[model samples]
Target: MATEAKRQKVDDGSESLQDFLQWCDRVGLVLSSKVYVSKEGTAADYGMLAKDSIEEGEVLFTIPRSALLHQGTTKVSSLLEKEKLSLESSSGWVPLLLALLYEYTPSQSHWKPYLSLWSDFKALDHPMFWSKEERVKLLRGTGIPEAVDTDLSNIQREYKDVVLPFMIRHPDLWNPNTHTLDLYTQLVAFVMAYSFQEPQDEEDDEEDEEDEEEKAPNPPMMVPMADMLNHVSNHNANLEFTPESLKMVCVRHIHKGEEVFNTYGQMANCQLLHMYGFTEPYQSNSNDTADIPVINLYKAATQGVQSDSDRRLIEERWELLCQMTQDKGAFVFSKQGCLTDSELHTALKVFCMSEEEFSEFKDNEGWEDDDDEDDERISQALSSEGLLELKPSWKQLIHEAARLTLRSYGDGEEEEKVVDSDRVLMEDRAAFKGLSCRQRRALQVRFGQKMILNRLMELTKL
Candidate 1:
């Protein structure tokens, strides 16, 4: 396994790391002599390493805006704009994907050296590329299966509806045979894996206070050399944007031989695996989360309330929750097993309320505005005992739901196949090492979730 990882990393460092470094210089990307890219035997295969001891807040590298590959700088930018094709957060990453496709021809592309750093589609580990059986066998209960299906459906529609027509209209721009769905999908994976969303303008900080849902995000761009750093849950470096350039700055001191780690945000293991094709093992992801679907919670909450009138009452209570909190969907639990979602707690309290209690609660139109402080006080008061002190019935329902959710991952025997922690991996290396990369990652994702759910069970234990 280690040998395969090394080989793949070497293959990905095409044209050699030195050539890519020279390319970075030619394109106005400045790399601090303190750090350089190398073949890291870690999950990323290739990662930036500290060449010398670096102090906190030190700039590791700076990439000029001109060096970025996006719709604005691509060779087809003007043509795309002229054709009235604009990409935004809503329309998916088609714009950048298209630009990548257009610039992928080595002879024509100015980014030849830069482009050579990437491996072919075979090297990609995103679940979108997983076999159907593999996905079913390993990722049955996770959101990945549904997410991958939705992505494939959308990609096909995007290809047939938008991409094909655009390419067909301009035959010289792209070849149908060469820019096939397979290649388009590969570009999609690249965009997902490598693209960086342009930082929001600092001048718009005040305006950003508006609901984020109402805002259209800046287009994703490809930043050469910036995407090489590997990610860890507790990262020591961050990417900071300035008017002139995007800078990678160390947040803490990095000693020589230490990998210069950057964060991919406070993401859960599931999200990391889904987007980047790898996850931090042994529940080490600080931002790891597991979701218990609202429907599952509802099923658990209404397990014994079989009468039509009682069911109606429960349905009405759920409606009330939606109206009051706008929180439908799932109850998200953090890595520590604490329920991070207050809305879910409120929902549980509402459901567990007696008929008269619910009447009084509804008549009061939920808790008063000032109740937030009281809720906080109550939460603090309960923290000494447990995260949240739920009523016996409420705890029962949530515990049952947590069990059901865990069971959905598969049987206990199957769950035992994957290592759950770093210590365990060390103790039983063969259990984890024998599995395929995809299988190992799949287990990591599910097991990370299972760990979270187990914590949830503990939190709500009756």
Candidate 2:
């Protein structure tokens, strides 16, 4: 309670997306009141819809721990001193940017809680905060600057006009309490694990350079969220290591008026966005050539099919299923939260298609002209009142990955199969479409021999 008498506070609070939807309908998490706009929804990022059919992989919005501040230590003068927080009106520097998110979390196992944010800002009792000509301008703003140094751009324009607009005119940054987005999502996951941490972690390890001089920890800024998930690149949200809080049952179903997408680049297209800076917002939209199947598990650890810890567990479960389908805005593949009991039936017969291979293709004698086209397809899957079930093990793995792309052979001039499904290749549309109802049932359960006439031409063309 060191208020120094509420130092001219600011909270009348009204930023209202109807009080962020009456605090997300008093916290049950369902948001989709049909609000899509780009021309003027006023951009601090917004997009919504599903007034009706959203079945595929359902859950579209979530962030709880009573909407976040989970702290441990972030001492830049205590985000000016915690004053004990929580939404009964969060106080001052939003508890010092959520005590810089107790320094590294998603539930930290590494970066040792950012070394207690550099030993609590070098045990600050303000030992002249930073004078030795400001430690030679913080050791010349510790490199990575090249073209700007009017004394490190006047100390980062005096930390963005007098310390980040006095920590963005505090009053809990604004809103009865915004938890400054759990302190800007721990400063955007400490800026995407900050250029992948360690170069002897850029200084501050002293056992005795005359001992006391520590305060360096505030660098955290890598802005990815899967490069703000817009612009699809043949996505299935497999940013893979399977972390849906240690999976239990959703290999694929995700419907409810779909937008769910993920695949930053190459388990074939956009190739994990070339290792992840991501970019598609219709850069002149068109397929832009993406057959994308680049499987080098380095050759499943020199062609043994698995082990170098199962090829680093298939490259850390395909980069955490493309960063959990770009932070769960859409792509929703669920290995039942992920594997068990005989490795979850061998990862469900290796990622999906077996009701005993559909009764051994309905006992084939060329079964009465495929039983008059499976009786005009069970009367149009009972006149479309809920029927898109193709999972016979992801249709025998997308027709054995599309007949191993009609017999692989890179550096080509040999791809003219007598059937050209209009082969456009790129600028965007040719194969991938709005697909999601759990990615057309994991492409008919892994490719049910080209999804039974591509599921009767996408249910007689939608």
Candidate 3:
């Protein structure tokens, strides 16, 4: 019975997709005869694929700016003009959200065919849609939980302060009975999933220079047909914007039957899953990253300092290190499951020194140059061979810090069990369906972080 229901939903979605494509044709979108949108044997339900061999640098399609669904392109602009509504006080997202809401109305919307292509709210797998319990259980240690909370709170506030008042003024456009919180949530989800930021042209930037508050980049937009392309880590297609149109051009040769993919920039599995509702497996993702909370490391470094003077000195040194790293813009952690060389070196140089070594370095106001013997000494201490020479207790502290981070997720035994079970389930298509899409995506993110934490702990052991 459930299987039949699922099939029905897919069929409905396909019909809507066909309607949208037909609408695109009616509006004069120039699509290549060599490619078409259809289901590929991958996780994405719909993706564009090459029907014939295509060379690098070929133009796949071109979408005229007028066909895009934005304040400038759609009926929303006309209605706002008629109503004398000014959205100057609100964020760019406010007007775009209103534009989406306007087009979502069934009888009044001119863009109904395009709007109908979106999946129902229940189909959204974004972490924001997950229950608080699920977030605590799966995302407690990660930054995603806090980010999801902030996004939901902000959107709710926007609806109350901005959208609700506008709807009250325009009763003909929004009937309270039909436009409920449920619909608002769905619209926000669609925008989050589908909106594109129209790149700010250099000419516009020059014009805005005299404005005291530099205007925020032109609001993100919804590009019809263009949003249909799915992402791959190393994609072969690129989206370029001009004064007249948005173009999808091939960056590399696409073999017949291969999916034409677009790069979403370098993103971690966690970010991809949270924002886009899917994750490439760790092995398949070249850009996979693990976000380590640096605060955990700070706590670990200062844990055993007994003397207040000594503690102050250590804190001072740590602050200097942080500023130096920040100046270079290199403090971020990643999924190759390790800290950057600079981060590792900074942490070791700051925390792994004896009082005598630290005092001498401090007297010099920190290492001044690469030629300094003290600087070379600190560098050598961070090397692999120097690991055996370090005090075992200092090494233990680093191990304990990583272990604490992993523990922040949940019980070690339970986390391991869940990760192991999911790994096996992921390999079996039948078993995979037992979990919701968000659950599957969240598990992959958690698993990736755990692997990195384990690697960090191993480094400490060495």
Worst 10 residues of 1 by lDDT: 1-10
Error of 1 at 356 (Å): 3.6
For residues 1-107, what per-residue lDDT tens digits would candidate 3 score against the true structure?
A: 01000111133566887888898888878999998988644236667889999998899999988888877666768776565345443445767767777777775
lDDT of 2 at 145: 19
TM-score for each model: 0.89, 0.20, 0.79
Estimate, for each residue in 135-208, the C-alpha lDDT of model 1 and write its tens digit.
88889777788888888888888888888888888899888898889999888877777778866776686666
Error of 3 at 202 (Å): 5.6
Q: What local distance difference test score does each model get?
A: 0.74, 0.29, 0.69
Report the lDDT tens digits of candidate 2 across residue range 1-462. 000010111122134234434544464333334212121121113223233444434443433323222232232334444434331121123333334443333335222322222222221211122334432322221111121223334434434434444555554533313333433433432332221211223234453345576543432221112222233444333322121211111124434444334322322112212212122322221222213122321122123335475555545444433442343221111111111122222222222223344234235411223334343443333232212343443334433433333333212323233113212321124343554222222222222222222332243232
Candidate 1 lDDT score at position 161: 83
Question: For every model in order, what is the number of clashing pairs?
Answer: 0, 82, 1
Error of 2 at 259 (Å): 36
How far does residue 321 in candidate 1 sit from its true spot (Å)?
A: 3.6
Among these predictions, the greatest lDDT belongs to 1
**How many angstroms is residue 18 displaced in model 3 relative to the true structure, after the best TM-score fit?**
2.8
Candidate 3 RMSD computed on C-alpha atoms after optimal superposition onto the true structure: 5.7
